[model samples]
Target: MSTTLANQQRSKIISLLSPAYLWLTVAIFLPLSAMLYFSFLSDVPFGQTEWHLTTENYQAFFQTTTYAKLLWKSIKLGLIVTGFAVLVGFPCAYVLAKVIQGRAREALFLLVILPFWSNSLVRIFSWAIVLRGNGVLEIGLNAILPFEVDVNLMFSTPAIVIGLVHSYLPYVILTSYLALQAIDDNLIDAARSMGAGKHTILWRIILPLSLPGLLAGAVLIFVPVVGSFMEPRILGGRVGTYFGTVIEDQFVAVFNWPLGAALSFILLAVVLVILALSSPILRRAQT
Candidate 1:
């Protein structure tokens, strides 16, 4: 009877999970497997007489300083964007979670996530128009100011950062809002009743509990920003030559599929390492 019940349970579990796992195998695993195999090859095996394995694609990264420097630049850019996003998002989240109430809260929350409703490419292109030398921003500033001013912020690092932050801000706000809302108002009230100041309450009671959400948001922003190509290309122009753009060039311009795959795999490894390092802190934040 026990053996029969175990077999039935196992079958039920498989029945429930089979479709999702099969979908993952088809969608994600198979592509990654193909990419991995390509990363070790000398060239793409399409219409080829012979194909051979080579580690030169990976070695080129180490032998050359160019990719490494660009990768570091991307990392730094990610950090800057993430930092700004955190600073801007946390305060907005706090106001929404604690200060606002009723219909106002709902409207504002809608506004916060409204960015997601629009296409990011459209948004970035819009930013390009707004930041041009004699563009909307410059015209607006000139209208307000007595003196003439140039507002050519387009095709620069700050423009790239601005575009990225605009896109990623919603992620941080959503995460921080959820975390902040989950905390009990009673705990804050009790702290205040004990003569704890606003700063003290925030430092001791709020930040600790909401840390996981904040970190998760930061990770979300950082990972994608590090691998971003589109915004940088559109906004940064020549100054936007980072690791991601180079990876893109390998496949599109250079016609080196193996090198592109290797670069992509290396980036994946880096992202995994970052998550692994942060796992401990995230675990602690929950408790």
Candidate 2:
């Protein structure tokens, strides 16, 4: 009877998880498998297009230095955006989680997430309007200061960074807030009672405790930023060509789906390797 009951419980657990597993298989795995298959093909096997299984798509990446440089550039962009997001978002999160309270906290929290309420395109264009030469930012700066200012950040790397950061900063703030919320106030009090300075406590206790959330936010920001084409294309102009834009061109402009798939898989592999290398730190943080 006990053995039968255990079997029934296992069956119930599997039943509960079946729908989610089915959705993942259909949505994620199936598309990834299709892409993987496409990456090994000479061309898209549709309509009158004659195609064959080939490794040239993958080989092309290693054969060209241009792809490597663009990929590295994208990786750098990801790191920069993630670093800025964490630096800015963490303080905002700390204030929200540990300092503020009641209605004021709610109001501020809403403001932090206010960007999400509007379309991203609107936000990027708004920044463009502000950052353009003789635009709001320059004019406003000139109005307040004695010195004349000329600010034109649009169509530049900084503009891309700003837009990406604005778009993704909330992820860092939200995750960091959740992690910071879990930290006990008593521990802080205990540290204070033991004569720990603000810096000491922050470095020795708070930072270590909140690392998982930081890493989680970093991953969330880094992964998307690396593959982002739209923001860079709009904000960066000629300077914005990265691995993502190259992949986009391969699909949209060049109609080279197999090459795009190969590039996409290479990006996936790079991301997986990064995650694997960092998993030990993530596990340590959770413990």
Q: Model 1 scores what on Cα lDDT? A: 0.92
RMSD (Cα, Å) of model 1: 2.0
Tens digit per residue, CA lDDT, model 1, 152-244: 999999999999999999999999999999999999999999999989999999999898888889999999999999899999988999889
List runs of model 1 lying over 4 Å from the truth.
1-16, 281-287
What's each prediction's clash count? 0, 0
In candidate 1, how many Å is residue 142 off?
1.3
lDDT of 2 by residue, 2-98 (tens): 9999999999999999999999999999999999999999988889999999999999999989999999999999999999999999999999999
TM-score of 2: 0.94
lDDT of 2 at 42: 98
**For candidate 1, which ten residues in a row score worst on lDDT?**
42-51
